[model samples]
Target: MTLRLSQLIGGQARPALSEAWLDVHEPATGTRYALCPDADGEDVAAAFEAAQAAFPAWSTLPPSERARWLDRLADALETRIDDFAAAESRDAGKPLALARDVEIPRAVANLRFFAAAATQFASESHHGQAGLNYTLRQPLGVVGCISPWNLPLYLFTWKIAPALAAGNCVIGKPSEVTPVTAWMLGELAREIGFPSGVLNIVQGLGPKVGQAIVDHPGIKAISFTGSTAVGTRIATSCAGNLKKVSLELGGKNATIVFADAPRTQLFETLLRSAFQNSGQICLCGSRLLIERSAYAEVRDELVARAKKLHVGDPLDAGNQQGALVSKAHHEKVMGHIDLARAEGGKLLCGGNAVQPPGRCEGGWFIAPTIIEGLGPYTRTNSEEIFGPVLTLQAFDDEDEALALANATPYGLAASLWTSDLRRAHRLAGRIDAGIVWINTWLERDLRTPFGGMKQSGLGREGGQEALRFFTETKNVCLNLG
Candidate 1:
């Protein structure tokens, strides 16, 4: 299959406005699959211009009409589901089942959710007899969205759906590594007859194209999903212009299994949480903090389960854990594995890469790694590895578990597995992360607000709350005397 990257601007594919280009690789074989144009400042400016021009008309449309466009876009996406999944798997090393079953479906659902949410933007009531006052939700004009490589389609939809639902034009900058699916989405938007300039996509490196988008005066807000470091940079740039910014950054999330928790159930939940998408999730439960009494049993089960995970080609139907995004990411994950050893963390099981039976040797595959005995301050415990690696730690009591869970700078998400209802409620309240799951990990409802509390990120990204984030409230007060 041949994949070609194109800039989607003004409702059409256009020629590259930049001189540079990069190869999008197929991680399973370490081969270049397509040449993605590296957009420069001029290209980003053009996208901004498109969005800025479209904003007035698009935003003026009634909320119900805006929703119809999103509904149409969702239908369009559904028609191309298989193609989207295949490209997602090839471009980002996601397992085919995951792309088909989880990512694409979730993306479609997000669009549908936002379509319904768009019509709920009624004016806020003010209990004041002094004057008639109500707040109107208004779009922020143009939103410049930068999505990460991991779960590119899902993250892109997370931003686009709400931005459009709130009646804003969007200029999206997907990660250069995983631009194929995002570009295809832009094409689908056009096919659905979304007005020209309502949505635009420019593929390029962050330093050049991303910076341009952030710096563009025409862009009223910046929504980003990526590493905390890059998020900080984007925040700084937005601050210079006082542009509205919402970021979902890195995480070192924890999964605390209490003594009363069902051991088998917790083990299975952790298995899915820590290794899904090879643990490339920002909200993945990377730290497993089991109650001291149940630590031995949980660790034993986890190690056995980790060994059973299938590591192989993403295209393979049976593979559970696939390769990291690229050679660079694979090496980075290996470096963290080496760091774990240096920090005196015992390698419990599966620290090295494995070429699956009958799979090519060149695939960027890494085994499900488990390490134990690392101190809370150790790099293995403190940093976000963004790979299929889980670190184990034991906590004696509830307070210690909560402290360990909140120790990291990140506060993206956390999970508590316990049959004790009181303890579950108490810890769920105390955990500093944004989303706390009781007896589950990484399970989310589209209608609930989702985001981190601390350095993890700055704002929420789901449901009516997310719609508010994309819009500014204006108060219109009039007096009739």
Candidate 2:
């Protein structure tokens, strides 16, 4: 029997008011394991109403009180880490170990981080001779958080935890592709006696539930992470309403390697940056720009290492790579590989789809793909394939490497491998990406602002930025005698 999931609204888990349901697939086996609500505008309206009703009281609570609740939520999430990990792996087709060690733990960390940040979230005060000017940061009444399917609960909590920690009531929309863990969070919220209507989870397709959240006037702000295309549409809708929106969108990041950098670390992190989570991470370095002096050596080693990555069921401990999130996404990645070939790119390693033995045979799995002979201007090099696909480009000098790194429409992140401190510092400044990692990739510091430049995304999130984004700022002036 397939389990039926519920929409969480008003601190209750119930079926959507509408009878329609969406089939929830377990990507590992291409099987339907559950069903979630195909929520419509009515469902969204209900959630919005609940959030709006809860906003005043919730926002009025002391920051310390909010922090306490968030801390409790974090504690609860940690207690059920195993369940969340298992659900995340089944829901998003990520390895169980990856979910346990990274994704779910990160979600718990998000709650704890924001919990601590809430008490520290402060307003600004300015001193002047005649008067005092102070800036107040207050929560937006009811906010929307729409998270993508790639990281499921990890990104879901990343958005909502801050909103809640900032004392705003949130109506969150998790991607229909992987909604289980999010639904599970709702169950936790209810069990912990989290105030009714403080956080609501609406499950369904983007056009239905997500669009409703965007269109609703009651939702004062939106924090969204997804494809650039979807983010664009959400921006358009929010523009007319003047609703505050924070978009963390797509990325075609670059990984640059210099000859003098540590070879072992470069090779190891390079493979991970290119192919981890099957390269679904928006921060993944899809473009590899190598200094000519080390191009051939890095390229050959990368190809050999990528070929060895095991592709199988997500639950299997031995497998390093798991199924793509869905059948449609799998086809999209495969299509991009085919496009690369047509564009005159040579496959250096695994480019074809893989049907691993056993249960994952019918799963959506793509082998780690590395392509060479692709110019920086080619679609395969510049576009965000968002799969286990990497394109190689050789640069002779710092100027060329910087140009190649900044060539794409996206400016989300860039990873540079270099022993020269001056070179790293100089390139870090010139690189258009929002994030520049020297000799490292995916090393996150929660305090740093995270976002993208140009078409990658807009605004900033993380730490104070996230807390501020979910709030409204007002400046007040006082006369001093």
Candidate 3:
């Protein structure tokens, strides 16, 4: 039975404005499992209307009241953790453990952290010789939030939680490719008795619904997570309206390994960093920079490790990696591998897409791939392949390593592995990325600023930064006698 998905207007799941439906395929097995509305501007306008209606009251509530609702949402999500994890794994072709252990948990944490932040939401007051100045952090009216297919609910909540915590009503659009879990969120929202229009979920093609959200003047602010090209368009649109925008876009991130780093830990970390979630994550270390002293060893070991990853159904306990999200995306990733060869890079290992024996034979699966002998500025090295593919390069010294790492147009995130405390701290500062992990990758803290620099993205999001982005500040001054 194919499940039907609808646009979540106000607090309920209503039929889309049109009867046209898009088939939702289960990425793990390449089977049609559901249908989502092929929503249009009418659906978007309806959602915007709901958000505008709910904005006045929702935005004026005491921060603590919003905090309580956030907590309630978190509690509800926790109760459905297993279900969400399974749905996410099946929906996105992520290994079930990865979904259960990382993606879903982080989403729960995002909600909880933002809920606490709402309780602690504070304004600023300055006392001066002449007068007193007070700054108010208040919500914009109705806001638009668009998240990509990659992280689905994890990032969907990341944008909306803070927007809601800041007291804004949100009209959210989750990618049509992976809309299941977000629709699930809409179902949960109704159960929780959430205020109507506070957080409406719209599922559709980005061109249709996403464009409508961006074009709608009623939406005062927009927070989007996706490719740089789309983000650029959003930025231009928002600029025309003088609307606030926070974009977390693409990344061609790097993993830097110094010879001084422990070899054992480095190998394991690199495997997960490069191949985890089939490299669908924007933060995945797609470019690897190794010290010349250890380049050969790291490259050889990475190939051997890549061979060991089992690509199959996400639900299988034995499989560490799963299929790409769709056949179209699978071909796109495979094409990059061919592009690497055409550009004269040597394929270290794993270039061809595979049909893992049994159920996964029907799915869209690509083996983890590594390409070497490419220059720093080569397209394969600089572009975000955004699949289970990596480009390996060698560097002679710290200066050379930094140059190679920063060669790409992106400056999202990177990982550094070295034993020297001084060198670790030094390289951290030199790396142009927003988040640099010394001897680690993907370690996150809710309170720290998170986002990219340069073409990677604009503005930061996380903890106070997220709350700040979703809100506006008004300063008032009074003269003293």
Q: How do all models score by TM-score?
A: 0.97, 0.99, 0.98
Q: What is the C-alpha lDDT of each candidate?
A: 0.88, 0.93, 0.90
lDDT of 1 by residue, 342-454 (tens): 98999988889876655446878889999998988888898889999999999999899989988888899998899898998998889988899998776777889888978
Worst 10 residues of 3 by lDDT: 353-362
Per residue, candidate 2 scores C-alpha lDDT tens digits across 1-481 of 8979999999988788988899999988899999999999999999988888898899999999999999999999999999999999998889999999999999999999999999999898997754999999998898999999999999999999999999899999999999999999999999999999999999999998899999998889999999999999999999997999999999999988988887757788999898899999999999998889888898998898998899998898999999999999999999999999999999988889889888878889999999999888889987889999999999999999999998989999999999998999999999999999999999998999999999989999999999999989999989987
How many clashing pairs per prediction, in order?
Answer: 0, 0, 0
Tell me the deviation in Å of residue 449 in model 2. 0.2
Off by over 4 Å in 1: 357-359
- Flag clash pairs in model 1: none
Better of 1 and 3 by lDDT: 3
lDDT of 3 by residue, 1-481 (tens): 8989877898888877888899999877889999998988999899988989998899889889999998999899999999999999988999999989889989999999999999987888998655999999889888899999999999999999999999999999999999999999999989989888898988889999999999998898889999999999999988997988999999999899999997657889899899889999999999999999998888888899899888888888999999899989998998889999999999887898888777778899898888889998778888888999988899999999899889989999999999898988998999999999988888888899999999988999998998888888999999876
Q: Say which candidate scores most in TM-score.
A: 2
Error of 1 at 263 (Å): 4.1
Instruction: TM-score for candidate 2, please give it.
Output: 0.99
lDDT for 81 (candidate 1): 91
